[model samples]
Target: MNEKLTKEEIMAALNERHSPEKQALLSEGRVAIAGLGGLGSNVAYALARIGVGHLHLIDFDVVDITNLNRQQYFMEHLGMYKTDALKSLLLKINPYLDIQTDCVKVTEENIVDLLGDEPIICEAFDRPEAKAMLVNGVLEHFPEKKLVSATGMAGYGSSNTIRTKRLMKNFYLCGDGVTEPEYGNGLMAPRVAICAAHEANMITRLILGEEEI
Candidate 1:
């Protein structure tokens, strides 16, 4: 039979991968991710693996067959609420993480309330309008918090174009910043994950007090 590792052992393994300073910062940082599809799901996965201390995930949708193409969810998770499913998966990765999830739709009126005092905001909505709403609302209401967003991650290849950009003070955007899902071109796993990685990496950098590019 396989032996189960204790929480201390699990944390020891994580600390080996990250420096004490980096791990300390990550373990103290709190990030809120809006939406739980391709971008949000993947970003959350990456952050959890790195031992981010707290995550506030908000998503009003449920897993569907279509999400299997690019999202982090599995076939078994189909039909479950995205927030609940993601929370389950993230906890499996790091049980010590402090995760708070909201299964309600994020709106202009409730964005700040849902996100609370988290200093990092991740924008992971798939629709253009929804993305704009979260970005605008957060920037307007919580200008001090850093906002990392994704755009134009559809299609495959051309991975180089997916980059992290400091759009303005306290605002960072990832992806090609142009491509959109259209005829013949659709969202795929590779590009979406790349964008998600960019967002996750930027979040890590900000948390570590590294200079933003």
Candidate 2:
């Protein structure tokens, strides 16, 4: 016979790993992720593993075979919408999670509506234009909210180069900031996940009341 852990049992294990106080704070954390590519997918995985109670996953793209190199999706998730696939994966990690999924592209017009409810927004688009759209849109429309973004995480550069920097009172940037895929080898898992960890850690720090990075 197969057995499944109850939600309470799962939560108890999470709290034991995260500590009761830290898990309590994490459980109250809310974030909206824009673009479920490498960075966003890894960030969502890290946060969900740490017991972030609520997450709003926004992505218009479907999982592609190319995404297997760096994204969290598996072979079984190919062709599935990123939001749906990621939500399903996250639920497997933390079944008690509260998740919201949006399958529409995050255009300037809809960005505010998609992310307004969440206190922190993560920009994880692959293209520069799309990244700018989310960052600019969130900063312009929701100045009071926090935005975490990434740049130059592509290629097999030194993992140490991946870092988090405070860009403004409400914005943070992660990654080497110099190794664009066009110039470097291309997006690899280690560097991408390293950058994503910076973003995820920064978001967690913010959630835990440590804003400075």
lDDT assessment of candidate 1: 0.90
lDDT of each: 0.90, 0.91
> Clashing pairs in model 2?
none
Q: Which stretches in model 1 have alpha-carbon errors above 4 Å?
A: 1-3
Per-residue lDDT of model 2, residues 90-159, tens digit only: 9888778999999999998888789889999989889999998888888899999989999988888788
Q: Candidate 2, 50: how far from true, in Å? A: 0.6
Cand. 2 TM to true fold = 0.96
Backbone clashes in each candidate structure, one number apiece? 0, 0
